[model samples]
Target: MRVVIAKCSVDYAGRLNAHLPLATRLLMLKGDGSVLIHSDGGSYKPLNWMSPPCSVSDVEVEQDQADAGITEIWKVVHHKTADMLVINIHEIFSDASHELGVDPGLIKDGVEAHLQKLLAEHIETLGEGYQLVRREYFTAIGPVDILARDENGGHVAVELKRRGDIDGVEQLTRYLELMNRDPLLAPVQGVFAAQEIKPQARTLAEDRGIRCVVLDYDALRGMADHNALF
Candidate 1:
């Protein structure tokens, strides 16, 4: 990981045009070829970012840029989308790189963990003709809660939560974005399932075309009672 604190201006050109005037900000370059520009605020969310399958290069600054107090130029380009994020540096406060090895990944809360297992076992509770493909469906970003096929054989990615919120919706959104890019799952859909869902989360999920499902823990466990009868 490379971290740099610098006074820079950012310009993004792709699906939309955006600009960040000159200011001191934190820049993170990860080994995965992703770049993020963050400010002192906004918590963990980056002000601007270029996801993986991208490249970053330090290019020579133009004469006019040099005259305008620009000391360096970094260009980040997405391989697939051809989107570009350019940063013009006026000065760098600090620059350092660290070798953080493999990560263990995220640990789910106990109830959340069980939710995934139960949802996978009773996959059809989502709807008739739903079939579970697998749990913890692997993607480059992270593991999706569950991957299944609908009646028409279309792929569906389910993200389970104990209490659905906006962050869960965003997480599912990222999964859908990455999964849909794969030729094998080009038309992947998403389901945000939880014991309770916030209105904001449901709104966001629906706006993104993701279906929301409220699970009944007791009912799900009731279905498991056949084992006791046996």
Candidate 2:
């Protein structure tokens, strides 16, 4: 992993286009070749990032650029989508690299966790014959939100998000990728479930042969409570 704090600007072109004016920010090149441009604020989220399955190449610094304090230019291209993230470094404050091993991934919190529990109890919300196998199904990479069995006896791996975007779909895809590797879970299907799923996310999910589920918190809870009364 490499970290560089530099005064830089960014431009991203692909599914969407974004630009960040020149500013001092932290640029992270993760072990998986993902690039993240971060500001001091914004919690853990980066100001801009390029997801993995990418290749990053550096451009030689010309003498004129060096005189202007522009020391580096990085061009990142996505392998599958051909999206690009361009980062131009004007001034470097710090630069270092670390050898960080495997990652355990995130634990859902706040509304996301609550949503997971709700869906687990009411796995039927997923489909008529779906039965909850477990919640927080742990794996080497991370815990799947919910694991279940569909009517046909196939496994289903669900990912819950408050607002499902392209990131959420990508996340679930990761989980499915790992989970399906095991012979026991070889046929696992993915469900991108969230209260609201963005159109782009839905399209991505469908393209990957994954199902998209729009969760209704109020109705889900009310149905669970009503079922309890019976």
* Every model's TM-score: 0.79, 0.55
Report RMSD (Å) for each prediction in the order shown.
3.3, 8.6
Q: At residue 163, give the lDDT of candidate 1.
A: 91
* CA deviation > 4 Å runs, candidate 2: 1-107, 228-230
* Residue-by-residue lDDT tens digits, candidate 2, 1-230: 99999999899997668899999999989887778888998654567776666899998988997897787989999786687998888889999999999866676677788788888888988899999999888754457889999999999999889999998887788778656645568789999999999999999999999999999889887887898899
The digit string of per-residue lDDT tens for model 1 on 104-223 reads 877998888877888888899999999999988876557898999998999999999989999999899877866775556769999999999999999999999999999998888787
Error of 2 at 228 (Å): 4.3
Candidate 1 residue-pair clash tally: 0
